[model samples]
Each structure stands twice: as C-alpha cells, then as structure tokens.
Target chain A: MREINVAAITSCVRQMCMDANYHLSPDMQARLFEAAETEQSPLGRQILEKLKENLEIAAADQIPICQDTGMAVVFVEVGQEVHLTGGDVSSAIQEGVRRGYQDGYLRKSIVRDPLTRVNTGDNTPAVIHYTIVPGEQVRITVAPKGFGSENKSRLFMLVPADGVDGVKKAVLQTVREAGPNACPPMAVGVGIGGNFEKCACLAKQALLIPTDQQSEDPQIRKLEQELLAEINKTGIGPAGLGGTVTALALHVKTYPTHIAGLPVAVNICCHVNRHETMVL
Target chain B: MDCRISTPFTKEKAAELHIGDMVYLTGTIYTARDAAHKRMMEAIRQGRPLPFDLHNSIIYYMGPTPARDGRPIGSAGPTTAGRMDAYAPTLLDLGETGMIGKGRRNEAVRQAVIRNGAVYFAAIGGAGALLSKAITSAEVVAYEDLGTEAVRKLTVQEFPVIVVMDSKGNDLYEIAASKYCTE
Candidate 1:
C-alpha cells in the first residue's frame, strides 16, 4: 500500500485552489478560440475576444478570472490501496482551502447560512465529494463555482416515455429561460437518467469533460450537437447582445434510471469555467 | 441609439440612455454586493445618512477577489444584478444614475429604473481579470466589518459596459433574446 502524507495533500489542495482560479484550462481556452472563429455574430465574436484577453491577463497576473472567486468545491478520488498519514484528510483539505483563499487573494463568497446568509470570511470548510477507486494514486480537482451561472442550474424529472426528445427540449428550455443571466456563449452540462442526487452530481461531473470533446456514444453525440445548435439559435448572443453563437458547447452524461422516471439536470457554467486537477 | 451622460452624473443624464447602447463609464463608481447593500438599505430605513454620496453615482454589484502583488484589485468582475433587485429601488430613488452588473432584473426594479432615471449596464459577468485593468484604484468606504462585501469606492478608467435596461423602459436582453427564443 502506498502511504500519502496529509501535509502533502494539504499543500497540493492549496496549490490546486490557486491554480484553478488563475488558469483557464488549455482545452477550454482552445474551444473558446475555435468558437470565436465560427461565431456568426459580430457581437459574439467580440465577446469571445474579450474572454480570451481576460484569460491571458488572469494567467499572467496570477489573479482570479472573475471577482466571485467562488466557494471551494473539491472532488477527491482516493485509492483504497493508499493510506493517509500525518493529519486528517478532511481537515487537511479544509485547511488548504482557508490558506489558498487568503494567500492567493481569491474571494471568500461562501455564506454560513442560506436564510440569514452570513458571509464566511475565509471561504473555509470546502464542499468535498470523495470516491474511492482501486489504485495507489489519489487525485483531486478543485472548481470555484461562481454564483451567476450556478443560480441558473436546473433539474427536471420526466416520464421515461418522454425519452431523448424530452431531454433535448428540457435542456433547451433551461438555456432559453437562463437567457443572458447565465452569461451568453455558455458551456452547458446535461445529466440524463440516474436518481435525483446522482443526476445532479452527474451534471456537475459532466462539466469536467474537455470542452472540445464530443460524447462517445453516437446517439448522445448527435443529441449534444443538436442541442448546441438550437441553443445558439436563441440569439442570446455574447452578453445577450443578439448573436449567432449563444452556447459554446453542450456536454451530456447519463446513467440508467427507474422505469417510471427519467431524470434530467442542467448545470450551466460561464465562459470562465475555472477548474484544475492534480494526481499524487 | 446615441446618448450621452456627463461626469458626476445626474438623474437627467441617466434618463437619456436606452437599452443596447454601448456605454463608456468614466469618473468614480462605488462597489457593493449583498452585505453592504442590506446594511445601506437598513440605514436608509432608519433615516440615517449613507456612507457616501449616492446621488448620481453608479454602484457596481461586485465582490472582487483580493489583489495580487503590484495590482490595484484582483479579478474584479460583476455579480448577478437580480440578487440586489430587492434593494435597488431604494438606491435608485436616492439618485443612483446607473447599475453595473450582469443578469436580469425583476419587473419592479425595471420600473424603478425608468421612474428613477437610472440605467442598468451589463458587464461581462466572469471577465474579472481583464475588467480589473480598467479600475485605477479601489478603497473601502463603509461596512468594513463585512470584509469583501464592504462598500468600496473605485476609480475606473474607460470601464466597458453595455446598457441592458435604460430609463425609457427598453430592455436589451429581453429584446435580443426574444428574437431567437422559439416556443
């Protein structure tokens, strides 16, 4: 069994937090550049230009791409064959989040309560999702979820009879209703099937896919393509100025569900979808 | 549509802007988000004077990340406007000329925009790092206890924003988005 030091995990998590905020993944950047090329609307193209410029500036300056530095959300893939030493893994992760937010100058956007909504000064106690895998390596991914696009996320429960067409319609409706609120030329992640919680998790997990890649299943790929086209036709344009390309990409993830229910969830991420992963 | 607004804006200057016009924001603007806005509104309700002169000023809905070395502010981008919709009318009535943020506003806020002669401008929602370049300086003005949510006075240069809703009751987002939204 491989032994991983808790201190190492803490350090890695802190670095991941800062790195995710400052850098736009190269795959995402490439897609945005490609979208700029094919975007028909002049306004949409202009928005893409500004977006690219923003990414460059953020990277060079070592600052967050957006003001809402986001709540720390960490996805951990721990190996069953690995034993953690030195400190508690959960506490270490939280400590990393606190340090990263303070040292990296990222914003502390998390609030203590939903109703009273008191601000948590250090953006501590990150929302962590863990999966134990059969390996000796541990992997961590940190995504700073901003409120703008997060506010537009939606989940729908459909009758199994509704099928693929229903899924398409639902995804389109979510983007349509979102309008400029989610920010235009958005990347959409669709989760089909699974239980309620699983479907929501799948939607967020789908966002982890590279922006340029298409779904492996031809049927899902076709659905993704169709949805992408339809959403752009909405002309919500860049910044909702009226444009041809309103959505940059449509990504879908699915799992089997109960006979009676077809669950669908849409997780919308803005142009600055910031995330990074590390293996140790 | 061609419209012009002067520096140290007035209620009348805000009245001329229509939805869809590209706006070049000059002069000083203040920043505040959930915490500060609530406090300011509470103060106003208690008949207390605001920390700064809100008359003819634009309030950017933002909670910027902390600054890195040699920088005035960190990735300083706009937050959702709707979150502040509940408290916006009060500021508008107090003579706010414009609002800078992204997303939709409630109907009441839209009406207030028209009635109060203020315009709502949409800044690129997540383009904070790039947007920070336009901010020359930033200093907290009030509600320091709230940390990042404190009210801040920001001096900006050529800050770019698009008018989403104007004083005349036009909404760019509604108009532009409706064209492509099929039932």
Candidate 2:
C-alpha cells in the first residue's frame, strides 16, 4: 500500500488553487478562439477578442482572469491502495485553500451565511468532494464557482414519458431566462435521469468536460448539439449585447433514475469556466 | 456607430452619451459592488458626507482580486449589474452620471438612466486581467474594513466599454435577445 503524506497533499492543493485562478486552460482558450471565428455578430466577435486578450494578460501577469476569483471547490479521487499520513485530509485541504487565497492575491469571496450574509474574512473551508478508486495516486480537481452563474442553476422533475424533449425544453428555458446574466457564449452542463441531488452533482461534473469534445454516446451527443442550437437561438450573444452564438457548448451526463420520475438539472458556466487538476 | 473619447467625466459630459454607442474612458473612476454600495447608501441615508464625491462620477460594479507584486490590481472585471439595480437609482438621483457593469437592468433603473441623463456601459464580464491593464492606479477610498469590497479610486487609460443603456430607454440586451428568442 502506498502512503500519501498530508503535508504533500496540502502543498499540492495550494499550488493547484493558485494556478487555476491565475491561468485559463489551453483547451478553453482554443475553444474561445474557435467561437470567435464562427460568431456572426460583430459585437460578439469584439467581445471574444477582448476575452482572448484577457486570458493572455492573466497568464503573463500571474493574476486571476476575473475579479470574482470564486469560492474554492476541491474534488479528490483517492485510491484504495493509499493511506494518508501527517495530518487530517480535510483540514489539510482547508489549510491549502486558505494559504492559496492569501498568497496568490485571489479575492476572498466566500461569506459565512447565505441569508443575513456576512463576509467570511478568509476564503476558507473549501467545498470538497471525494471518490474512491483503484489506484495508488490521488487526483485533485479545483473549479472556482462564481455567484452569477451559480445563482442561475436549475433542476426540474418530469414524468418519465416526457423523456429527452422535456430535458431539452428545460435547458432551453434556463438559458433563455438566464439571458445575459450568466455570460454568453456560455458552457452548459446538463445532468439527466438521476435523483434530485445527484442530478445537480452530475450537472456540475459534466462541466469538467473539454469544450470541444463530444460525448461518445450517439443519442446524448445529438441532444448536446440540438440544445446548443436552441440556446444560441435566444441571441443572448456575447455579453448579452446580441449575437448568433449564445452558447459555446452543451454537455450532458446521465444515470438511471427511479422508474417513475425523470429529473433534469442544468448548470450554467460563464465563458471564464476556470478549472485545473493535478495528480500526486 | 458613434464613438466618443472622454476623460474624468462630468455630469454634463455624461449627458451627451447615447445608447449603443462605444466609448473609451480615460482618467479616474471608482470600483464598488453590493457590499460597498450598501455601506455608501447607508452613510447617505444617515445624512453623513460620503468618502468620495458622487457628482459626475462613474462607478464600476466590480470587486477585484488582490494585486500581486508589481501590479496595480488583479483580474478586475465587471460583475452583474442587476444585483446593484436596487441602489443605483439613488446614486443617479445624487448626480452620478455613468455606471459600468454587466447584464441587464430593471425597468426602474432603465427609466432612471433616461430621466437622469445617466449612461450604463457593459464591460466584458470575465475579462478581468485585460481590463486591469487599463487601470493605471488603484487605492482604497473608503470602507477599508470591507476587504475587497472596499471602495477604491482607480485611474484608467483608454478603458474599453460598450454603452448598453444610454440617456434614452434603449437597451441592447432586450434588442439582441428578441431577435433570436422566437417561440
């Protein structure tokens, strides 16, 4: 069995948090360039140009791409063959988050309460998710979620008979209602056929997929394409100033649900979809 | 499209802007978001003088990240405008001329923009790093206790923005969305 030192994990998490905030993934950059080429509105094209320039500036200056550095979210995949040493894993993760926010100059955005809202001085106590897998190394993925798009996320429960059409309608409606608030050409993650909470989880997980990649399943792939078309038709455009391409991509992930109910959830991510991963 | 280059905007200067025109802003502006706005408004309600003059000033709805070494600010970009809609008309009535943010505003804010001769501009929401380059200097003006939410005075040069709502009732969001939002 392999032993994973808690101190090492903490250091790794800190680095990942800082790096993700400071840099935009290459895949996302390429996709934005592609979107700029295909965009029909001149204003949309201008917005894309500015977005690309922003990414370059962030990378060169080692600063966050957006002011809303977002709340810290850590996803971990632990191998059964590994044992943790040195410190408590959860505490270590939080310590890493605190250090990263402080050292990297990223904004501390988390608040202590949702209602009566008080700002939590330090952006600490990260939201962590863990999954056990068969391996010797642990993998961590960090995605900073901003409030603008997070507030627009929605979940719907439909009769089994409604099927895929129902899912498409719900997604389109969410995009339409989101209008310019979520930031367009956006990335959409749809979770289908799961329980209420699970559907939301799956929807967020689907966001990790690369912007240009297509689903392997033909049926779901078709749905992704159709949803993309319908959403852009809303003409929310870039920065909601109006354009032909409102959504850059639609991602769907599905799991078997209760035989009687079909639950659908849509998670909207702005063009800044900041995420990064590391294995240790 | 009409283009205007303006600096250190005055109320009279801002009144000249129209909806859908592109403007490049230069000189000093201030940054504030929900938290700072609330505090500033509260101070106003209490009949206390504000830390900075609201007359003829443009407020950018943003809470920028802390600056790294050798930098003025971190990825500083616009946040959603609707959230600040609740407090904006009050400032407009107080003689604020220009506002920079993202997303759409409510009807009341839109009407106020028209009635008060104020203009609302939209900056690319997530393009914080690129936007920061335009900021030559930044320092806290008030509410330093609020951390990133503190009111900051920023000097900018050739900062790019599109006028989404001008001194008229025109709204780019409604116009653009309606074209493609076919039932």
Candidate 3:
C-alpha cells in the first residue's frame, strides 16, 4: 500500500481553496459567454456582460469573485490501497481550510455554533465527504459553497408512479420559488432516485460536475437539456431582471432507490459555482 | 432611463423613481443585514438612539468580505432582501426612506414602502467584485462585535442599481416576470 502524507493534503487543500475562489472555471466562463450572446433581454445581457467583466477583474487582481467566499466543502475519493500518514485526514482538511481562508484574505463566514452564532474567525471544520475506491490514488475536490443558493435547496420523496413529469414539476417549482433570491442564471443540480438524505447529497455533488460536461446516460442527458430550456423559458433571466438565459446548465445525477420511493433533491447553485480538484 | 441620485433620499426624490429605472447612487449610505437589522429594530423599540439617524437614510443589505491591505472593503454586494422583511416596516415607520438589496421584497414590505414614500433598489446579486469598485470607503459605525454583519457607514460613488420597487408600489420583479412569462 502507498502512503500519502496528511501534510501534503493540507497544502493541496489550502491552494485549491484560494484558487477556486479567485478563478471562475473556464467551463463556467464559456457558458456565461454563450448565455450572454443568446440572452433575449437587453437588461439581462448587460448584467451578464458585467458578470463576465467582474470575473476578469477577479482574475486580473487575484481577488475573490464574490464577497461571500463560501464555506469550504471537501469531497475525497480515497483509494483503499493507500494509507494516510502524518495526521488525521479530517483535521488536516480543516487546517487546510483555516489556512486557506486566513491567508487568501477570503471571508471567514463560518460560525462556531449555529445557536449562539459566533464567527469561527477562521473558516474551518470543513464539511467533508469521503468514498473509498480500488486504486492507490486519492482525489480531493474543494467547493466553497455560499449560502445564497444553499438556502434555496429542496428535497422531496415522490411516489414512484409520479415519474418524470413529477421530477420536472418539482425542479421547475424550486427554480420559481428561488426566483432572484438564489441568483438567477443558476446551475441547477438535480439528484434522483436515492434515499432522502442521499438524494440531497447527490444533488450537491451533481453541481460539482463541469457545466461543459453532460451525463453519459442518454436519458439523463436529454432531461438536463430539456430542463435547461424550460427554466430559461421562465424568463427569470440574469439577476432575475428578465431574459432568455435563466439557467446556465441543469445537471442530473441518479442512483437506485427502494421500489416504493423516488426521492429527488434540487440543489441550486449560482453562476459562480466554484470548485477545484486535485489527485495525489 | 438612467438617473443619478444622492443618498438621504427624500420622499419627492423617491417618488420620482419608477420601477425598472436604472439608477446610479452617490453620497453616504449605511450597510446592514440580518444581525444589524435585528439590533436596530430592538434599539428603536427600546427608544435608544440609533448609531446613525434614520431620517431619509438609505440602507444597503450587505455583509462584505474583509478588505485586503489598502482596500476599504472586499467585494461588497447586496444580500437577499427577503430575510429582512420582518424588520423592514418598522424601519420604514422610523423614516428610513430607501433600501438597496437583491431579490423580491414581501407584499408587506412593498406596502410599507408605498405608505412611507420609500423605494427599494436592486443591485445585481453575485456581482460583488464588480460592485466593490464603487465603494469609496467603509467603516463600522455600530454593532462592531458582529464583524461582517456590523452596520457600516459607506461613501459610495455611482453605485449602480435598478429601482425594483417604487413609492407607488410598482414592483419590477412582478412586472418583469409577467412580461416574459410564456403562455
């Protein structure tokens, strides 16, 4: 078995956090450009132009793209053949988050306690998810999630008989309810057919998929394309002022569920959907 | 139409604004979000003086990231306004005439705006990096312990916004959404 140093993990996480906040991924930038070109409303087009300019400024100045730099979320795919050395894996990740937010001059948005509501000073205790795989490599993805869209996420347990139409209705409803609050021209992540909690997790995970990529499953790919068209038809537009480019992309991820249930989750992400991945 | 306005916005000036008009605001504005709003409401109830006078003042619902060295503030942009709906009418009654935020205000908040001759402006959400260039200066005036959520006094220059809700209760969100709604 190959051993990976926890210190190395810390440093990797730290840099990924900083980079993710500073740079708008090229896929997201390209999609925004396409959205702007095709958007119907003049005001919507102007807003999209400004958004593009803002990202350019962020990249040039090495500043964050948005004020809410987001809570650090770490997704790990660890190989069963690899052993972690030097420190506990979770603490290493937290330290990385703490240093990243602190050194990067990003916002420290986490609270020490949900009830008492004291700022944690350094953004730490990152939400971490781990899955073990067969190889000797460990993959880590850092996604700093801002609360604006996070507050808009929803989960529903649908009766299996309701089927695809039910999924469409639920996704549309969530986007409508989000309106401008979640920040329009959103990237919608839909997770279907899992248990309730798993579905929600999968929905969030789907958001990590790059905007340029579509699901390999033909049916799911078609659904993603259809949902994108229907959402834009709402004219919620960029900044929800009104336009034809309401959603950048709709990512759908699915897993097998029990015979009686089809749990669905919608995790809405703003256009600044930031994530970075590294393998070691 | 584009209009340039100064803050401590008066009833007459606010009435001149209609839904969907683009506005660029200059002069002093205060920043407050969930925590600061809650505290301001409580202070008003207790009859204590506010950190800043409320008359005709405009408040921006924002919690900006901390500044880098030599910067007044980091990417500052409007947060969701609906979270403040509970405390907004009380502020309106206290003579606060304008608010800057993103998203749809509740019906009650819109009514309060009409009743008090106030206006609500929408700054583009998730455009913090772009918006920060307009803030000339920022300083915490109250609730300093709240960190980013503290009430900050800001000097702004040509900060862009759209008049989303006017003194007469016209709402851009409703108008725009309905305008584009497909049959």
DockQ of each candidate relative to the true complex: 0.69, 0.72, 0.75
TM-score list, all predictions: 0.96, 0.96, 0.98
Query: For residues A27-140, could you state the per-residue lDDT of candidate 1 as single tens digits?
Result: 888878887888766666777899889888988878888877778889999999999999889999999999998889988887788898777888986899999999999999
A1-280, model 3: which lDDT tens digit per residue?
9999999999999999999998978898899999889988999999999999889878877678888899899999999999999979999999999999888888888888998888888988789999999999999999999888899889989999989999999999999999899888899999998798899999999998989899999999999998888998897889888878889988999999999998999999899899999999
Query: Which ten contiguous residues of candidate 3 chain A have the minimum total lDDT?
Result: A57-66
Taking chain B only, the TM-score of every model is 0.93, 0.93, 0.98
Report lDDT (CA) for all predictions. 0.85, 0.86, 0.91
Candidate 1 stretches greater than 4 Å from native: B1-6, B178-183
Tell me how far the alpha carbon of residue B33 in candidate 2 is from the true structure, in angstroms, after superposition. Answer: 0.6
Best by lDDT: 3
- For B1-183, candidate 3 gives per-residue lDDT tens digits of 899998779999999999889999999999999889988888888988898998999999999887889989888878899999999999999899999999988989988998999999999888898899999999999999888899999999999999999999998888786667673
- Which candidate model has the greater lDDT, 2 or 3? 3
Worst 10 residues of 1 chain A by lDDT: A38-47
- On the 0 to 100 scale, the lDDT of residue A182 in model 1 is 82
